[model samples]
Target: MFDVNARIGHWPYRPVGTVDDLLKNMDALGISCACVSSLDAIHFLNPQDGNDSLARAIAPHRDRLVPLAVVRPEFAGWQDDLTRCLESHGMRGVVLYPNYHLYDLDDPEATELGARCSEAQIPVFVQVGLEDARRQFGRTIVPDVSLESVGAFGREHPSLKLVALGLKFGQPDQLRQPLPKNFYFDTSNYERLGDLEFAVSHFGVDRILFGTCAPLFHPRANADKLRCADLTAEQREAIGQGNARALFGL
Candidate 1:
């Protein structure tokens, strides 16, 4: 199976293991491949450093680990960083952290970056939430990027391929209007009963991708959600791996 959401690097609040450990966990969960980003990139002064670290670490396992560069559009030299990430690092996609990076989705820099990625035909993964708000550290709490904002961003950039990670089962429904056809979501924070079925029925099966917010959350738990969901074999296969394969051209 292909995991659309996974991370490698240090998470200061938790014990996020190395790439080897990530591989072992994926193997244990019967996950064949995963799209990974750098956790360090979220908090780094120069996020490209974290992207570089991820590129080097995943070099030997490129076949199994697809790298997604973390880009802070608000930062200076971000245009060059985006170019290097796509050309030099050979990243399949880019992950955005508007919450941690302190920018709204409608910001001009974000709009420019989105337009560029759309032109490049690369998917842009937006991290909606990294940790549950209730459990966040008191002093360093980071709010989630609102789904309304995400919907707005999708409306503005209709051609951009967008995937929102770390959203709960019912969060997307909170949007009053429909998101763009190119918008997608990962199944990591979905936990309620019938959540997967709800997502499929609400968003269509093609838009749902299997994701394990691994090394931060247990990979097995997320995998079990897919295994236990009341979906047909074809539907399950599509969400588990087929969708990701088609989306990322794996």
Candidate 2:
């Protein structure tokens, strides 16, 4: 299975550390690969240094760990950073942390970055927050990015493949009303027994990807969630790995 959302590096608030541990954990759970980003990139003012760290760390394990570059579009000359990530690091996609970067989705720079990614046909992952709201760091009180704003971004870039992370509150009815066809959701935030089944029945199985939210949250819990979900073998295969493979060409 390929995890669409996972991270490597030290998380200050928690004791989670090392990409080696993440690899071992994924192995134990039968997860063959993970699309990972730098946890350091999440908080850094300029994400390029963090991206460099991630590239160096994953250089030897490129087959198992795919690097997703974090780009804070609010910073000046951010487009060049994105270019370097694709050209130098061989990144498969880019993730945005609007809450951490202190920018709204409606900001002009955000749209420009989206357009650029769309033109390049690169996948875009937008994380509302890295940590749970109730247990967030005292220094940084991050808020969830609005689902409405996500819909707007998706509409603006109709062909771009967008994934919304850390979202726990949208019903299928509400999501389908505005979200475009290219928008997908990862399962890291899904904790309930019937959530996956409900989402599949209402919103299509192709739109869901298995995610563990590893190191911050247990990987086994999500693996078991997929293991026990009421889905056919084909559905299980799709959500567990097929969707991610198709979306990111894994």
Report the alpha-carbon TM-score of model 1 versus the true structure: 0.97
User: lDDT by residue for model 2 over 90-172, one digit each (tens)?
Assistant: 99899999888888877999999999998888899998646777887677678888777887888889989999876674533
Q: What lDDT is obtained when candidate 1 is compared to the true structure?
A: 0.90
* Model 2: residue 234 alpha-carbon error in angstroms: 0.5
lDDT of 1 by residue, 25-93 (tens): 899889999999999998899899999999999999998999999999999999999999999999989
Which candidate leads the pack in lDDT?
1
Error of 1 at 89 (Å): 0.6
Listed per model in order, the count of residue pairs whose N, CA or C atoms clash below 3 Å is: 0, 0
Candidates' lDDT values, in order? 0.90, 0.86
Regions of candidate 1 where Cα sits further than 4 Å from its true position: none
